[model samples]
Target: MPRRPLLRNLALTAQTVGEHVTDDPVLLALQVSRRLPRAVSERAAGLLTRARGAGVVRALGHEMRGEREAALAALEARRGSPVHRADAALGLGRPDLTAALLEAVAPDERGAGWSAAAARLAAHRGDLEEAARLAARHPRNRHLARRMAGERDTFRGVAPSLPTKTGHTPAPGRVLHVLTNSLPHTGSGYAQRSHSILASLRDGGFEVEAVTRPGYPVQIGVPWAAERDVVDGIAYQRLLPARLAQGQAARLQQHAELLAAHVRRTRPALLHTTTHFTNAVAVEAVARAFGIPWVYEVRGQLADTWAAVRGPEALESERYRLFQEREAEAARRADGVVTLGEGMRDRLLAAGVAEDAVVLCPNAVGGAFTAEPEDRDVARARLGWDVPEDAFVVGTVSSLVDYEGLDTLLRAAALLAPRCPELRVHIAGDGVARPGLQALAGRLGIAHLCSFPGRVARADARWHHAALDAFIVPRRDLPVTRSVTPMKTVEASATGRPVVASDLPALAELVDHGRTGLLVPAEDPAALADALARLAADPAERARLGAAGRQWALATRTWEANARRYRELYARLGVTAPVR
Candidate 1:
């Protein structure tokens, strides 16, 4: 996090742009716009426009101009230096090209960049041992070093190292949380859930505070972030450092030190952190230092989520194997386990956690969501989204990721366009997949009826929820989707909108097949279309289902209710915090 020299910053900017220029054009543009000056951006946009063939600068221009395939093609075709060509090939997802480039040189002769590319190629090919060895070759490459050291630390495990105070009494009912990121800066489901939990707990009268990972919002593109922000009455503490350590083990140790200092100052009775092992490492270390109990919430199958994007075969990869091994290790070692639902709870229990240790606190609604939803016409008018009176709107408000299977919704829209002229598609929210999904809708010839209104701000979420007649959760049948419950779907139901979702275990727990909402086979556009068509045709049935769904959410899924359960669970663990 230290201020870099101008030359160093320039070199890093070039390296970063070159690294993602081919496969992730969006990433390249983001980097350019955020890191470079307007003059620099314009120059980059036309750097190699006239000079043809494959080169990083030319590829940068191609990516800047939104020519993805052409940028990748340029990366794949003409190249000079083995390091540059290898990096380009790796970016293009062509490990074979990287292998060919490296074959001409000795391992000792290959420079740092080539070694890094070789390591990535090895990881892509599932050779984790080779990846590790290659990672160690470039000791100065902090990114690879961090990844390498993370695996080592996960195996060695996180434990207490700092000394405890002789006579420091903790606030009896105080609880401290360690988080990766939080609101006003990040608006992902994770951030929203964290805020809801903290806010509800605060309302329930337990003194609660959250500390983000060291160098957080600052690290994530916000350089002017303050040291603390009180969001909805909960204090979100920041541990901003002038510079983060280089390797994962070092960085984790530094984070633990920073948190330990805060823990000493706050003196909380209990510590808490969510899934994925790194957070647990620091929390575990700090909890042990203070001789206090800690709870680890298993939010999702993070390893499965990581592999879900790579492909089915990625489950066999070294990184995936190590990720699960480490996560289970952390979960088992925690003082208590809290999870979303049955699927996730079972995974933790199967991983060696005792049955009595795990508690289910499913995703729920609170605050604004508990209120009655506005009429569709009223909501549409307020949001400035025009819609005909007869139009039947069906789409989801979610993070538009690939695993969400939004393309399936686009295809279903195409199928329903002819028979149901009033059908309209308005899939809200944003992510890397939005551009691709929009293109898919265009290709299917449903672009005229479909609307990709981009990211819907959290404050405006209720309006979007009220504007739709039926909400669709067309998730792909991936391990991640099957286990991870979505917060938006529950919010939709709480808005009195009937839900139509893939027949997955996690989602099945949320929707009561015939009563609250309908569950269709995953990835089946025809089945999804049929379900939506029925809802569109029968206004009464839609009302019945929507009302029933709202009742179910009210009865079972509320942050206030979840907060009560959390207090009960903590009491069982000897965290005798006074609950109002």
Candidate 2:
């Protein structure tokens, strides 16, 4: 094989192995380099002696270390490389420099990288047409261009406007939601939250509609249906094409066009989308076409979430930068912005969104959670926990993902095992990290104390919370975790269970430290263990905290309350519907 292809394959293999084996980027890179043929390795080392070559590697290394300025400096040193120049310029917020460098590169040489960078620059500069044009140059980016256009008029001519309400009392104007995924397919927190929001909106007297993107629930194959179906009383219109062979951009265009047709047929007053920039892009196009305002509900900083999983270097990756820029652009363009918590709102404000434009509609409780709390012993028995009747069960019902810090919980459990011999830890939920967490539990000698009952059905969510004497949110201190308020914590509180969570800003917003729940220092097993031990030792304190938490959740964190907030926000944006 040729050197470039061989090196590329080696790099990919190294990355795959590194991800599966360890978290160290330097080690991963070294492993990749070591796998190269001796001659190739020597040549690679030689290139590093050159300023431009050294600059390239240094930039990547600095980015991985979260050293933004250092990465820029390294990129600056690589003046001969147009790609590095563009990246450095973009990082410094100099779109003029970025565009110049991008334009200087040949189209073929530029490939998808230059196209993506130029498209992002154009979007950042508010040249949606130019952005779309540039994005269309690459197969992977075509979807982004359509999203940038968002039904807005270009040289391509104007899009059709949605029919407006004729009467003062128009039949509750429909609000169509664009989603990445929804119920009867995926069971992630994002999907559940979308279902809750949509249900609440429907019950609030508005005709709410949802359309999921293509290739959803990719893990399970389900036949596509274009016709609208009423699932659990909420109407979902499926728009995914039966056969999708076109590139992502073309698919996005198709989605927008189809959604536009749906909008005309439904004549919704506005559009709404959540989480990702891709969803916003598609909705923006359709909304713009119809001249309808749209709302952008940011559930989490997905870029940060992705970076946290990959490593620090991934934060400064081009993809991460583009994701952030796109999200910022969407937030800037949307008529309203809704986020899950104050921490997320602060981020939006810092990103230049007006304070008044952002609404803090937190995750909330409904369904079984709102019903009277179930007895702990009864709930535990129902879940088939073979524990002593007097044993203290400390557990959490959450997706067993890495950032969730379940390993920390296992470590904490180990520390508390000897002190609180009757302590049992139940982790209810399944994810990629389950095997690793289970292994960690065994290594900590708390495997006997820890129980992984896999994913609990949504219907059984309340019971899962009920079974726990105390719930825990042991999320590590990552930018994403710090900004996101976990719905699990709120749900646990609503179930009248005291929460033991990491002392992060988002959690602090929900759990009133010593009042509603105990807040321990993040990533510190000792602190976590101490808090759990304290809660385990005092039943009266647990009851007191749980009662206060339940009252707080009832007062502030109900889906009804969240719906009301959305209603008020919509009204402010001139979308009015009569109260039922």
Instruction: Name the candidate that leads on TM-score.
Output: 1
- What local lDDT score does residue 61 receive in model 1, on the 0 to 100 scale? 62
Q: After superposition, how far is residue 280 of candidate 1 from its true place, in Å?
A: 1.0
lDDT of model 1, residue 279: 90
**TM-score for predicted model 2 compared with the true structure:** 0.72
Compute the lDDT for candidate 1.
0.79
Worst 10 residues of 2 by lDDT: 151-160
TM-score: model 1 vs. ground truth: 0.88
CA-lDDT, candidates in order: 0.79, 0.74
Q: What is the C-alpha lDDT profile of model 1 across 227-331, one tens digit per residue?
A: 788777778888876666654667788889999889889999999899778899788888887888999998889888877766767888777887888889888
The true-versus-predicted C-alpha distance at residue 127 of model 1, in Å, is 4.5
The lDDT leader among the candidates is 1
| Per-model TM-score versus the true fold | 0.88, 0.72
Which ten contiguous residues of candidate 1 have the minimum total lDDT? 1-10
**Alpha-carbon RMSD to native, per candidate:** 4.6, 12.1
